[model samples]
Target: MADSSSNSLFIKPIYIAFVIAFAFLISSPIGSYAFTAQNVIDSPLLTKKIGTNRTIKVDINGNGEFKSIQAAVDSVPEGNSQWMIIHVRKGIYREKVHIPSSKPYIFLRGNGKGRTSIVWSQSSSDNVESATFKVEAQHFIAFGISFKNEAPTGVAYTSQNQSVAAFVAADKAAFYHCGFYSTHNTLFDYKGRHYYDSCYIQGSIDFIFGRGKSVFHNCEMFVIDDKRLTIRGSITAQNRKSANENSGFVFIKGKVYGVGSTYLGRAKGAHSRVVFAKTYLSITVVPAGWTNWSYVGSTENLYHAEYDCRGPGSESKSRAPWAKQLTKEEVAPLMDVSFIDGTDWLPAWL
Candidate 1:
C-alpha cells in the first residue's frame, strides 16, 4: 500500500459513484422500459408447442405442404378438435384468409410480423366484406403475424365504405405479437373473450371496435389523422349496450401514440364500457380523453375509466367530466387476467 489515506479517498469516490448510480437506476424511467422489455422477451405464447404437434406448413414458394394459406386451411378436417399449427413462411401473402366457426383449436403461426403478412385491398359498405383476415372459430390462437388491409384511404365522413383488417367474432381467441394495419376501422373486434399480447394496432377511425370482453396486454395503438374528418378519430368504439352484458374492452400496460390527435374511446352505446390501466398515453391523445357523440343516452352507465396511467396525455384536469380516474379497488377486478378467464384457457406455459 503506497499510502493508506490515498487508497481511502480513491475507494470513497468509487463507492459514492456506485451508490448514486444505483439510486438513479431505481428512480429513473429506465426501470419502466426494462419491465416492458422483459414482457416482450419472456412472452409465454412464443413457445413452439401450442397444444399438439400436428403442423401444416404454408409457403409462398413450392416447398411446403400447401402453396396458399387457404389451401392448407381447407386440408384440415371440418370439425378440428385437436390443436393444429398452420405455420406460414416468411413472405407477404396477398390474399384474404378466414377461419370458419366450425374449425376450432387451430393455431396460426408465422415467422414474424415483420416478415410475414396477409394483405388485401378491399373497401365495402359491409364491415365483414372489407376484412382481410377473419376468425369466427372459437379456441383459436395466432402468433407473429400481420393482417393488413391495403385499401386506399377513403374520404373520412363522405364514404359509406369501411376497410377492416381483421374481424374477430368468436370466443376464447388469443393473439400474440401480431399487427393490424388499416386506414379506418382497422380491427373490428366483433365479439369475444379475447387476449392480445405484445400486439400493434394502427388505424385512423374506430380502430378497435365492437363488444368484446377482451384484455389487451402490452399492446400498442397507433393513430393517424383522417384529414377529411371534421371530428377527431377514436381508438375504440366499444358497444356494450347494457350493464348486464358482461362485455368491455380493458387495455392493460399498453401505450398509445402517433401523428394525429385521438380519444381513448367513444361511447357508442348507453353502457359502453372501456378501461385503460397502467397505460402510457402520449400527447397524441386529446385532452377530452373520451367522447360521446351520437350516443344520446344518459352517461350514468358508461364505464369509461383510466387507472394509474402516466404521460402528458394522461393528465385528468381537462378530461371529459364523464370520464373517470378509477380507484385501485375499482380497477382490481379488471386488471387480473381472470377478467377474460385467460388463465384457464391460455397456454399451459403461460
Candidate 2:
C-alpha cells in the first residue's frame, strides 16, 4: 500500500504539469489577456527599439526639457529612432510645430485634450503653408492633445485658400481622443493611411480635408457658424492621381452638428472619394446633401457616397443629382477590414 501511494503522488505531479501546459497553449492564441501576460513574462527585459530611453516631461512648472513644443522636438535625436514619449502637462502651448520625416515613432501624450492645447493662427493665404502642424513621421501617434489654428473669422472669406490646423503626411499614424480645432481645414490627411477614433474635429469649410486613405470612427464633427452657411463645405479632396493609389476617406458612426448654415459638402479633387456610413447629421445640413466644387461639372468619377445615415439631414430625395446614395449591397465591398488596416504600426498608447 505504501508503494502504491508513492506512485500515485508521482503520477499526480505529471498530470498537473500536463494540464498547465495544455491550458497555456490553448489560451495563448484565443485569449489576448493571457497572451499578453505570457509575452511580458517571457520577455521582461525587452524594450522599445526607438527612443527607448528618450523621455521628455513638459510641465508648466516642473523643471525638465525645453518649455516650448518646438524646442522639445528639436532636441530629440535626428535619425534612426525607435520610440520616444513626450509627456505634456496641462497647459496651452501656443506654437506651430512640425514632426519631420527623419524622426519616426514619436508618441505625444498630453494631460488631456481639454487642458493641453497646442494652438497657432495661420491663414492659408498668409504666406504660411496650409498645414499648421505638418507631420512627416511614420507610425506617429498623438493622444489627449488638441491642435488648434485660431485664424480670424473673416480671414477665410477674404482668402479662399484652405487653412489646415493639423496636416498628417505619414503612414500608419493614429490619433485617439484628440481635438482638432480650426475655422477651416481642421485636419488634413495629406498622404498615407491613418486612423482617427473618438476624436473631436471642428471647422467651417472643409474642416477635414486631404488626399489620403483614412478612417474616422466614433468622432464628433462640429460646424461652428454664427449664421447658417453650409454643412460640409469641403469634406474631401482626395488626390488619387496614380492608378495604383488606394486612397479614400471613411467616416463611421460620426455625429455632425451645425452651428449656423446647412450646406453639407463639396468635392475638391478630380477623383476624390468619401464615404459616410452609419452617421448622424443635424438639421443644419442642406436638403441637397452635396455640392460640386464649382457647380459646373459632375463628381461622378470622384466616388462620393453615403450609406445608412440617420437624422434630419440624411434625406436622399433632396440629395444632389450627382451624389450617389449607396445601398448596403453596393457599400459592403468598401467596408473591408483591410481597407484602412495597415501594419500594427501605431504606438501602444494610441
Candidate 3:
C-alpha cells in the first residue's frame, strides 16, 4: 500500500468529479435546465388571482409564490387568453426569460420603476439567444420594470456587438413607465404593433431596432458610447423588408440625448423607415443625422424623416438629401396612438 502521507495529498475522486460538473453547469448555456414547451406544461401554476384577470406573485425573498420570473411564466397555461398579471417584487433578477407565443395577455407588474431589474449578458453573435427578456405573445403590457444587458465593452464585447436587452414580438403590446438599457440593439422591436409610453431606452448602435410598428409617447431615448470604439453610432436600425410591410418607428414627444456623437440610424433593411416628430435631439446627434450602412441594395430606399423637432441637432440645413422634412399633414396619422392601434387595447389606466 502507498504511504499515508501520499494518500492524504490526493483529493477524493468524488470531489474532482463534482468540481468538473459544477464548472460545466455554470458556463455552458445548453443542457442547463433547458426550457421547452413540455417544461412549461409540466410546471404548475404558482398562484392565480381570484376574480378579475388572474394574477401571480413573484418575490425574490420567497415571500411570494415563485422566486424567478421564468418560473412564473411557465406556470401559466398555454393559449391563455385572460389577462394574467405577474406581480414582481423589487429585486435584481438575473435571468433570460422568454414568454412563448402560446402564452398571451401577460401583464408584468413591478413594484416600481428602476427598482425591479432583470439583467443578462449576450453578444450580437448569439442572435436571438442574447435577449435578456423576450415576449413573443400578444396583447402584453408591462408597468414599472427595467430590462438590461450587462455586457461590458472592454471585456465581454468589442466594437461590433449586437447584445439585446429586450425583444418584443407581440401585437397590440404596450409598455408603461419602463426602462430598457444596453449598448447594442437594446430594444429589439421586432414584428408587432407596440406602444411605449413614459418609458426609457438607453443604448448605442442600432439600439431601438427591428421591423415592428412602434410609437413612443413621452419616452426617453439615450445614446451611449461603447468604450470609445467609434466617435458615433446609430440610434435605430429598422429592418423593413418591403414597402407594404406596415412597419416603422414613430417617436412622438420624446427626448433623445446622451454621450458621444451618434446618427439617428443606419438602414439594415432596404425599406427601413423611422420618423421623429415633436421630439428633442441633443447635440450628441451628428449634423448629418443619417448614415447608410453602404451595403449594395440597402439604405438606398431608407425613409428617414423629421417634423417639428426642436433641439440643437434638429437643424435641417445640413441633413442628408435622402431624409425628408415632412409637413404637419404628413405626420397627422402618426401623432395619434392609433399608429400602433393602441386605441383598441390600451388600458384605461394609461
- Whose TM-score is greatest here? 1
Ten-residue stretch with the least lDDT total in model 2: 40-49
Per-residue lDDT tens digits for candidate 3, residues 41-160, read: 000221232124567999999999999999999999999978888999999989999999999888888865678999898776654778899999987878888999988542235533
Residue 8's lDDT within candidate 3 is 61
Error in Å for residue 174 of model 3? 1.1
Query: lDDT scores for all predictions?
Result: 0.88, 0.72, 0.81
TM-score of each: 0.89, 0.78, 0.81
Ranking of predictions according to lDDT? 1, 3, 2
Better of 2 and 3 by TM-score: 3
Query: Which has the greatest lDDT?
Result: 1
For each of the candidates, give the backbone clash count.
0, 11, 1
- Residue 35, model 1, lDDT: 52
Tens digits of lDDT, candidate 1, 47-131: 4446467889999997899978888888889899888889999999999998999999888889888988999999888889999
Alpha carbon RMSD to native, model 1: 4.1
Encode model 2's per-residue lDDT on 1-350: one tens digit a residue: 36998899999999999999878876775455455534311111212423366679877665667688777788778884667877788898878889888888777777668988898877765323855677888878777889888766533345635567898988878777789987767788778988887789987776776678888877888877732243346444555544467888888876888666545566666666788888898886778877775544546666678999999888889887777788999888666335666435533321
